[model samples]
Target: MAGPNAPWHQKKNHPVRRHFPFVLLFALLGLSALASAPAAALEFELGAGPVDEIDGDGTWIATASWLTGQRHPWELAVGMIGARTQAQGVDTGDVYFVSVSRRLTWKRWFVQGGIAFTDSDNEVLSNHWQFRTGLGYDFGRFSLSVAHLSNANTGGRNRGETFALLQVAF
Candidate 1:
């Protein structure tokens, strides 16, 4: 059996394991923020795009997002993304993220940006700090947005990803 000097005990594998607790804490906080929002403040979005140009050798991408009711310029959102990509021998992967966005609107056009904590299953992508930005044109209850997600080179690989989305508010 390997002891303290074992390869498994090295810092590389331990990074994600060590950070698991922090991720859990952040998730909890995000949930609480969502809970605090009014029921009528929920928004849903669906997005799709090409994958390889963003992060991997995938052909297509799909994402779904839910944003909690807005408190002026601030809102909390949770998003799930799935990509059909061949990266690190995996044919598919998913990324789940929580973000706080600041939105500014003038008439029917809006711009939003925020930082996020991403948990990804693809070996080529990192499972931590990410940034997201997007702009959309709101048509009452419906909108179209173009957004991008990236680790900002915080990880070993940071190709980033982009999406074109259609959103609806209930």
Candidate 2:
């Protein structure tokens, strides 16, 4: 009899990765929809880069937006994130976070900024507070965005991110 491991093709179909940011985005969106939200939106992000010469890493993040008024292009947003990286045969860095943001729009361009509080899995990697700023363009129900996140305690490292945003109204 052949054991399950005997053949390379015998492996079952399974998901190998847990996408936390996407999960959080959907959860936040569902909550916003149920609350009869106006101009509420959710965004998800993934990132990867070199932490050092010997290693590379990735992270996932999500954010939700709420519009305060119908007339002005002012809105407030909340975000959450989960990130992890391994180096030198050890899981040496991680970040779990929550944040708040405000956005203002004019014609096709918009400017936004936010502040975040992060908890690190490894205390040595703790940066505590992170700040972000961005510029975006709106095209119908979709948009494109670019942002930067910086922290004083992060050893002069900054995270640059780009996002493709899509919105659907019910």
Question: Cα lDDT of all candidates, in order?
Answer: 0.65, 0.46
How much does each candidate deviate from the true structure in C-alpha RMSD? Answer: 5.6, 10.5
Query: Which segments of candidate 1 are over 4 A away from where they belong?
Result: 1-18, 42-73, 86-92, 121-124
CA lDDT, candidate 2, residue 130: 63
Q: For each candidate, what TM-score against the reference?
A: 0.66, 0.48
Kindly list the per-residue Cα lDDT of model 1 for residues 1-170, writing each as its tens digit. Answer: 54556663454554445666886786677667667767677666665555444333545455555667563345566666675554555543566667766677888888888777776634445557778788888787777778777777776666676767676665
By summed lDDT, which 10 consecutive residues of candidate 2 come out lowest? Answer: 8-17
Clashes of each: 1, 0
lDDT of 2 at 8: 28
Superposition-based RMSD of candidate 1 using all C-alpha atoms, in angstroms: 5.6
